[model samples]
Target: MNILQLNFEAGWRGGERQTMLSMLQFREEGHTVHLLCRAGSQIGERARAAGFVVHERKGSGGVIGFLALSGKRYDILHVQTGHMLTWAVLTKLLHRTLVVYSRRVAFRLKGALTRFKYRKTDLVVAISEACANSVQALGIQHVPIIADAVLPVSPNATRSQMLAGQLGIGQRKVVATTSALAADKDPLMLVDAIAALKKRRNDFVFVHFGAGALEPEVRARVAALQLQDTFLFAGYQQNVEALFGLFDVFVMSSREEGLGSSVLDAFSARVPVASTSAGGLKELLADDRGLMSAPGDAGGLARNIGQLLDAPDWLGAMTSKAAEYFERTHRLDTMADAYLVMFEQLLNERRRPRTAAIATAPAATPGIAVESHNQA
Candidate 1:
């Protein structure tokens, strides 16, 4: 199958990582996979470096411009971000190719144009049940759940040691987080949790592995709380996955999340996770897989982190179960295979006679109102 993966994000976030994983897996499975991303984007550069045929556009306008002028078509155009949904729908209208959108956020859909664009897609795959619920609220039915898969990490002891030395993490238990310091991620709450945890114990160092718009506020809180030596902000490393094994525990203080893919990375690395029960995080951390706390509960989050770091036996048991869960449900091949099936199914539907095919317009979901122009 020929596929064109589209992600307009300039940064290398969870969504971009997933997009790269899918392209790699599809190509490995003997399918043609190409990428279309903004010029100089991390994903585009990485894709180009990896020898994939990458089509680079300038920006959102450039994307539409390319679609209008280019005569090439593909078997599938997979939209990997929410902001790119409208362009993907337009491409479908232009080229008659099946558009598959992967909705990775749990934020409620607002605006009539947003709902209309989403409904026009041939398929909308939600990464978690919470995200699926949000999409279904727009009266779009059969939103299949396809959870994000973790790119397997090969432990690099040499790299870990070098990073540890650089970060002054000698013999200190590392409490790490890979969440972007943003509003949804609640970096302020994390700083408060770190402060609360510090009063009880000062042996661990909190190393954050992301950068975002709220960096200044988070930095101010860390300084005000006098966590200068304790809280370390290691902004957005390209191969941050390699450092997960160095962490004793991984904490995510997200106010909302789709599925917390970083938690899956922690599980793969045998690092015990302490995260809030935000959105699909509840589903991932259920069955004693990890320590869970209510969103915004800094005290509870701190306590959970303490337990994970202090109780080695319980941590081992939880990590063992979490690793098993990751192995079973979050493998890269499993997710790639599901996408292949979805692609083939959509292709078959498109090949059917016009009269036999069903309409793509979303059906009205009784009692579930779509709030137009209401931004969440």
Candidate 2:
């Protein structure tokens, strides 16, 4: 099968990492997977580096150039961003191919006009139950939950790990979070939490990865909290998968998340996590696999961080349980099989020609649609 995956991310994050993992897994299974990425984009380059074919097209909203590659033959065009919905719908009209829209964030329905513009995706794959609820609340009734994946369970990039050690204070205790510094991610809350902890245990290191519009404000908050020395801003490093294993505790304080990919990465890295009860955070730490805080509460977040920092005995058990859950439920191969099943199901369901898509010749693939459609 030939698959085309589209990701409209400029900076790397959990979503982008998941997209790459999915595409690469499909390719390793003997399918030709192509990536449609922004021209001059870092992801496009990384895709090529990973040995996947990338078709560079115009990416910014003003130009919307990925349209040119939409007509190319593909078994599935999987889109992971809601902002790209309009373009995905537009591409559907021209290509007449299956468009699977993967919803990752929880947002209210836009006004009628915007809603109508993006509802044409053939299928909507939500990453978590919370996200599915948000979609259904928006009047979309056909959402499916596929969960999320953790790329690079253990840090293999030796060079990347060495670089992380060299970054900022060498060998100080590191408590890190990975995010794009976006408003919904609530980076400031993490900063505040770490700062408060600094008063008691200033020796611990606090680091955050990724960059976004909130850069200045995040920095300002660090200064405001007087944690400039303790909190280190490690902007968008490609080697996070390698560096994550070095952290003592991984944390995320997002106000909203479609599915927390970075959090999954943290789990895969086997570092215990401290997160909030935000959109998809609970999915990762359900029933005491990890600690959770109330959304947008810095003090509450601080307390959670302090609990893990203060209680060294329980950290090992927490990570052990998390690693067990990840291996059993979130394996990459299982995720790939799930997606293949979904694509094959969409392909096989037309056996009786019940819908217009089946009025023509009904292609048959035995035993293909019986598997799960979850590419973590």
Residue-level lDDT of model 2, residues 36-145, one tens digit each, is: 77777677888999888887766545324455354446767788666566676765666656778777787666687556754666778888988888778767788878
lDDT of 2 at 209: 79
lDDT of 1 at 320: 87
TM-scores vs. true structure, each candidate:
0.92, 0.86
Error of 2 at 70 (Å): 5.3
Error of 2 at 291 (Å): 0.7
- Predicted structure with the largest lDDT when compared to the true one: 1
* Candidate 1 residue runs with Cα over 4 Å from true position: 354-376
